[model samples]
Target: MAEVTTSPRTWSPAAAPPHAPHSGGPRWRVVVGSYGFRLTLVVLLALAAAVGILTYGNPAAPGSSGFWVIVRSRFASVGTILVVAFCQGVATVVFHTVTNNRILTPSILGFDALYRVIQTALVFLFGAGTLAATDGLGKIALQSLLMVGFASLLYGWLFTGTKANLHLLLLVGVVLGMGFGSLSTFMQRLLTPSEFDILSARLFGNISASDASYLPWGALVCVVVGTVLWRRRHVLDVVALGRETATSLGVRHQREVLLTLVLVAVLISVSTSMVGPMTFFGFVVAMLTYQVVGDSRHTRTLPMVAAVACATLLGAYFVLRHVFYAAGLVSVIIELAGGLVFLVHLLRKGLR
Candidate 1:
């Protein structure tokens, strides 16, 4: 006993060294590594693309008054891009969530068909002059109202019963889309060549075609809708876990789906009415977003989707406009690329 106590050991708690927690432990986590890096990289690239588009090949010096004037003129295109990208990106992601299907896009919900019908009918009944004459807030509001109303009615009716089914809703949407397309085609066939030419321009999705006056209103809707979605990200996360899980988590799954569809309809409507129907743009954005985000959680997924969309659009716009001098084909090129990607995805992964 005396020999054992010879060292006179100090057993004070303060004398012990502290242990460091594992870096991978939840208690010690900081950054999200690639998730954060990719997101930040995308955002920076988007900013750079925007700067280039606004400043590149300016006729006047950067500090000159003429340069500022040119930039101001170009700001409309940039604003249009922002509004369209935001609307499409947000709408596509949320649409995927509600349907629990990544392959489907808001375009398939008949917005494009409805938009085409509206434009074609305008030209068919009142002639091509009405297309230009109808370009105002009133027309846009009317278009958005019709689209959203259609969605609300469809969702409300479909999700009302105990056997409320998403696939059935999708089937019905497809059938209706085909019908609308047929109607549009018939109307176009009856129109004169000159009328068809004007109608064709409206049919193609053109970012530059978006009226400057419509940008603010579109952006306002996006801001309000985006605010709602972002604030409810957690709830969306639960909803993404599927209906049973969401209901168990105290969320009203049916109500949420209806609400999400209605909001998505608004977004798609605004973008479609502003820039014509972007059939494959949102599909490609959502597909690429799903591949990049690496997480199903809406919190991380949503922002990443938005950044990727902005970067994609801005980079493509800058290149096609400045480099290729094919500014008018930006939408065409995007749709082509999107279609290729869609076909590839279908061949490889099917409809999951």
Candidate 2:
């Protein structure tokens, strides 16, 4: 038998002092400690090894002399994947955090659609051959800048409002994406079959031989935009808590959100321009990262986890394409897998 006695002072909640900071944890603990980060890091490291295998251990290359060729090709492919992964991951995470919803991707907000519209209009205004002949780097830069300008305009309205509701903002974004899609479709219908074929390929986010030439410019844009997002990672943590809560905590919520939106647009535009439109990659990466990390703070969790996931997926695709498939558009396969995940996520959300 135990005898229990409590003093009146101890029983009073108000009399208790603030909780002391916790200790006795691992001295070299990884910050964020999300399962997503650990898994992503593992996946990315494995992917790097896999790329090494693909580049150096190919049997088809009859001689050791072909290693450099394999290296060059793999280098281009990995570089492009890194850019796309960073662009899509950062953009999707920031966009969802700003809007306070997990279901929405940057594409839902007309980012990808806007890119298509610009591309289509350019082809329509200039003949396809002339457009093709244009400097690829210049096009990527100009396109990204245009996207940033458009994103800034679109988000400016939200800053005027007192609060932004998640569902409402998603509704508006979906509607706008739909509008842009419809306009792109209408424009495509007016083109010749050959021209429409070109448009169709562009619309689906194709990363084929014809599109590889845009890589250098796309890489540059991705690096610039990725740096911008990295600089604002701390601000992202505050923005995730919704507008009012963030503002109450002395964050310049609107300005920061708008700037993030523009950065996201730049990132999306660069990546989309590189490979085409990836409708669900970001949604998949970001949602998985959130679920994996169990924290919304962008500071420790956003770039590291998101970038790793993106790189792993793309790297896996490269391995499969070189090692197994060898005859398909890797982007199509990834988009299909990503779309399925998005649907499952939506169904789960609906059930909840």
Model 2 C-alpha RMSD to native: 8.5
Give candidate 2 misplaced runs (Cα > 4 Å).
Answer: 1-63, 157-172, 208-224, 326-328
| Model number with the top TM-score | 1
The TM-score values for the models, in the order shown, are 0.91, 0.79
Clashes in predicted model 2 = 2
Clashing pairs in 1: none
Q: Give the runs in model 1 whose Cα sits over 4 Å from its true position.
A: 1-32, 350-352
**lDDT at 25, model 2:** 50
lDDT of 1: 0.89
> lDDT per residue, candidate 1, 1-352, as tens digits?
4555456687876676554334356433445456887899889999999999999999998889999999988888999998899899989999889888877988888899999999999999898999888789999999999999998899889889898888888999999999999999999999999999999998998876667888789889989999999998998999999999999989999888888888899999999888888888888888888888878888988898888889999999999999999988999999999999988988888555
Error of 2 at 191 (Å): 2.3
Candidate 2 minimal-lDDT segment of 10 residues: 19-28
Model 2 Cα lDDT, one tens digit per residue, 55-110 = 64565554567766666665656666766777787778788878777777888777
